[model samples]
Target: MDNQRRGFPKRCQCGEPVVLKTSTTAKNPGRLFHGCPFGRDGNWYHTFKWTDTSMVEEIEDLIEKVENIDGAAMTLQKGVNACESQIDTLAMETRVHLGVVEKEVEEMKMQLRSLKNIVGFVMVMVLFFMCMY
Candidate 1:
């Protein structure tokens, strides 16, 4: 089984519970971070470095960072929102294309049935002519 506890839970650095908006990775390993809405201007929490011992201190530092990094956090938020919008658009388009393909498949089935009926009729006519002969 995979070690599911890869990072710390979504909490702030100040040992105070902050509302977590989202979680994203950073350039460093074991340094995943979260965005807290409790900052002075609702900025991103600092990148929390995870260690086995000082998890509390790490969470506090992250809360302070979130209070500090306003510009960087706003950029990240915009990027996330844009990507989500694009994904929603793509999902809708895919659903529409799937519907069209399903309709075509149904039409093809109907055509196949019609062709089978015609072939059956021709076979019966040939048998009748043979009997007359």
Candidate 2:
């Protein structure tokens, strides 16, 4: 049954159903594969792989290249997303810090104005008493 023709259904060890493709060979026989539906589980329950015959090797290489490109794309997208999030976070933090600084400056200005008013009132009081004397 291992040498069965391509496109045939084969039973997995766990009783999962899989289809053998046209890439089976003599040496590395019996590899199963499936689409993205089974990708998360780390085992392709719906398909299998075989040895590297000349024809199979060419096809395998092409498939490997395609998968590599896909993986690189995913990594790049993830990196970009991470960088964007970091930038947003920094912007928010900067805005909050600026707001705090502005509030502090306003408070200091008010205090200075109050001190000036008190000094001016004391000077006028002294001048009035001195003139009377």
Candidate 3:
């Protein structure tokens, strides 16, 4: 990976550009090394020791760290999305509750008006009885 990122080395003795390939065997999983592109034709130029194991480990470690950071960022984004959805749901609930409260208030106002009319009629009846007496 590093070699690909930095660019391939100069041509081998076979006059073909070396290719960087990762080892996939259980013994050397994820190990990066270089090889001659024409090695299958018996040119056989290889450099397994060009990069030290420690260097390969360092690069692998950096790659793992980057992957972890990306995973964490995705998790945080999902949490933010969930919070926003909850906020929207609560806002809707609050609007519905406000509507119900407003209706109750209007009903109370109508009841109060009816009570006031009843009280005024009682007062007038009392005044008429007093005049008669």
Which candidate number maximizes TM-score?
Answer: 3
lDDT of 1 by residue, 1-133 (tens): 1223234545566556534332333554454344334554234453232344245655766777787787688988999999999999999999999999999999999999999999999999999999999
Query: Given candidate 2, what's the lDDT at residue 17?
Result: 58
Clashing pairs in 1: 13-59, 13-60, 14-60, 44-66, 45-66, 46-66
Error of 2 at 103 (Å): 1.6
Q: Deviation in angstroms for 82 in model 1?
A: 1.3
Ranking by TM-score: 3, 2, 1
Instruction: Report RMSD for candidate 1.
Output: 19.1
lDDT (Cα, 0-100) at 9 in candidate 2: 33
Q: How well is each residue in 59-116 modelled by candidate 2, as lDDT tens digits? A: 7667888999999999999999999999999999999999999999999999999999
TM-score, candidate 2, is 0.47
User: Over the stretch 1-133, how does candidate 3's per-residue lDDT look in tens digits?
Assistant: 5644333355566666777767677987887766666554244454333345536666777898899999999999999999999999999999999999999999999999999999999999999999999
Query: lDDT at 82 for candidate 1?
Result: 100
Backbone clash pairs for candidate 2 read 31-48, 31-49, 32-47, 32-48, 33-47, 33-48
Give the TM-scores of the predictions, in the order they appear. 0.46, 0.47, 0.55
Superposed on all Cα atoms, the candidates' RMSDs to the truth, in angstroms, are 19.1, 11.8, 9.6
